[model samples]
Target: MKEKKSAKTYKPLQILAIGAHPDDVELCCAGTLARCIQRGDKVTIALACRGDSASMDLPGDKISSIRSREALHAARVLGAELIEMGMSDYGVDLTLQAKQVFSDVIRQTAPDVIFTHYHTDYGSDHNNTFVLVRDAALAATVGNFRTSRPAVSKSPLIYMWEPLAGYGFQPEIYVDITETFSRKVKMLNCHRSQREWFRRRGGVDFLDYIEVVAKFRGYQSGVRFAEGFIPLKNWANIGARSVLP
Candidate 1:
């Protein structure tokens, strides 16, 4: 009998994972990000919003402040740096301001790969972020595109993390994440403020749901735990490297 072929492994020099809110990155792709960091890849975590409007009990600015701190802790746990784009939580849009913010992030990070929300996410902010990041990723590579910073010589490979709603997302690939699953949960626990929000919604244990999703995706791909992703299409020959195994 023939032995099974090994999955492709990638050690990208740098990776940036962007989320619509403070905890979105942890909820979606923290395992993958954690794995990247373990392999000595420099990882940068970016959020389109400070998650200011996520809670009504706290004022917008206060919520933003709290979430920013929480995000920093989470990033530290994952061995990644954090960048908060300072957009409103639910008001993220595909405006010029958003485009420029995302472009600036791409230029500043200069990551070999970027992971962000899927275009078809159920949340308005998530979908809008997808639009801006997609545009900005392209804009960051254009020499004539006047951004605050200089353009990068090349655009990084972009991957869509699984959507928050999970209903409409069609994952095309899976990365086995058995080794980093616990660390991913620990990283997510850093977002202390969001616990009540999830607790009130479906009475679901947030961490358990995340683990279950990873396990389900892993089962689909013959692994013990995993994170799924769908590559952005229509880009010729870019994003061909596999960062997940």
Candidate 2:
């Protein structure tokens, strides 16, 4: 009889998702993150801004507080830890200070994979967040780039999640989220303040909008529901193994 090969065993990944606003991660890659959690991975959702200016009528501070609570609820729904950078809405910048802060987060989380906004995504906050995360992933592995935490041994793999409405983003990979689609919807619905904010500001039902986008991506990927991603694939961030759930 021929000898049988042993089954491969995989380790749980530490996933870090950095977003420009409270609900950005949920809007873009919640399904993928939900799949990661289902496979026993630990996920960290880091928001560059508190979304203080997302409301039409509420004061900045009041809306920020409400959004923070909503973000916590959303994190709970995904079973992920939340990190609020407390940066001002529309105020995220690609400064050295911002880089250091993100590098520290990378070190503290020690993620095996990272997901963030596409570089050319709409809004200054989202674009700056992409730059900050891209640069910080490198900084986190440099000993001279000092922070509250020590440098990580290796840079983590970085993947850019879809932009709003999938504009100008060509996904290199797709994750079938059909099984986790309901969880993704639940996670996004946790951001109740955003729903009302979008309705008032743009007459858009945020939930309906996201569902439509998910369905479109699913169609493109031949799945019932899906989320797409583009890997950064820089030399330092490349690895032989696949990290996505």
Candidate 3:
């Protein structure tokens, strides 16, 4: 395919996580992002949605602004760059137009690794997120797509972070974020809306719940805390030497 022509430049960033909602990336892979930051890697979180339609209490638009601001906070806490696609929160339909938008972002960021929601997710937004990211990343390398965005040289690594626990899911890779547990907490704390939700009315402690999940996943990696993901089978490379075992 003829590569697209552009004046845009690519960065040697190590990681990028795309989420269906504003906070999804932080919840799913903040720990991983934190670890990458510590290793001097440039990490980014691209929000697929502005999160305008995500809420049971606060007004969607109001909550959306709050969520957008909070995402910057979470990204700051993890020392990662955060970009929102500015798409409607729950209006992510799988389409060529959507793919074009996603492809543009991919070309702009030029990430080395990309993470998004699993396709078999509980929410339609999350499922569509997977489709969008997959198609976008693949299209980002093709020039014939005729996008204003420049085509990236190498295809970024693609990974899918799981939904909440009790979803009967498993991870193909676990990043031992023991050293970044505190940073993870810092990132999660930036999610003030979530804290207010479960803390004020729900009368439940989500922090404690996430603590257990972090520890459980960490245990699998023989660490203090961790986030897990299932790497895309075709996109990920493997060899005897690549096996963790």
Candidate 4:
């Protein structure tokens, strides 16, 4: 007898995962994004900040460039296109301006699925990224709002990725990523600046946080490792029908 394979609903996804920091997307949706790509989805990542906050000695502008490069490298490793909203570090507010940027990204990427920080987070950037991504995912279609980017599809599926949760985080949808766990680690390792920064907290070993989170979620879903996501909207159209025949 032969082992069976899981269903490969390889939908072509115009997917976007937004983050407040360069490493946020790697920590949150990199595994899921890898899985989507493996199954033939087109994925994109938008960083709200270049993660200049990780350093104090360096000039913000200088660190910002380094972080953006690091984010591009990480996204490339995960096989996703990368964009930076260039919102000021720690300056991400639920302002119309932020929404305008979100509107632009959504208009361009035309995401079929949008991922971002959970509603409950410990940082202003994280919270605000969620507000803008969620709002823009739905609002990108309205020309009246007037984003410079050409309008794309309306009402894409939106999900919230991990919240870093030490403040008591929870997830609604858990994706089994046991097979893709190593790939997730690979994605994290691509963010060199972050890897170096976390080393101070406890180098290389500290990187296991992503794996630990995935393993915990995988257990919930009966897999060895996984990433969890909570939909911004209560329900989404999830089925083979959404996949191309």
Candidate of highest TM-score: 2
lDDT of 4 by residue, 158-220 (tens): 777777743566676777676777877887887776776777654555367886777778878
| All candidates: TM-score | 0.91, 0.96, 0.86, 0.87
- lDDT to native, each model: 0.84, 0.91, 0.77, 0.77
Question: Of models 1 and 2, which has the larger TM-score?
Answer: 2
Q: Write the per-residue lDDT of candidate 1 for residues 1-245, one digit (tens) a residue.
A: 99887985654577889889999999999998888887889999999887877674889888889889989998999889999888786879878877888999999998778888888888889988888878888888888887789998777777898876478776888887899999899998998888776777667678888978998898898989999998877572166556553
* Residue 200 accuracy (lDDT) in model 3: 70
Clashes of each: 0, 0, 0, 1
Give Cα distance to truth, residue 111, candidate 2, Å. Answer: 0.7
lDDT of 2 by residue, 23-114 (tens): 99999999999999999999999998989898878899999999999999999999999999999988898789999999999999999999
Tell me the deviation in Å of residue 123 in model 2. 0.8
TM-score of model number 1: 0.91
The TM-score obtained by model 4 is 0.87
From the highest TM-score down, the ranking of the candidates is 2, 1, 4, 3
RMSD of each: 4.6, 1.8, 7.5, 4.8
Ranking by lDDT: 2, 1, 3, 4
Q: Which is the winner by lDDT between candidate 1 and candidate 3? A: 1
**To one decimal, what is the Cα RMSD in angstroms of model 1 from the true structure?**
4.6
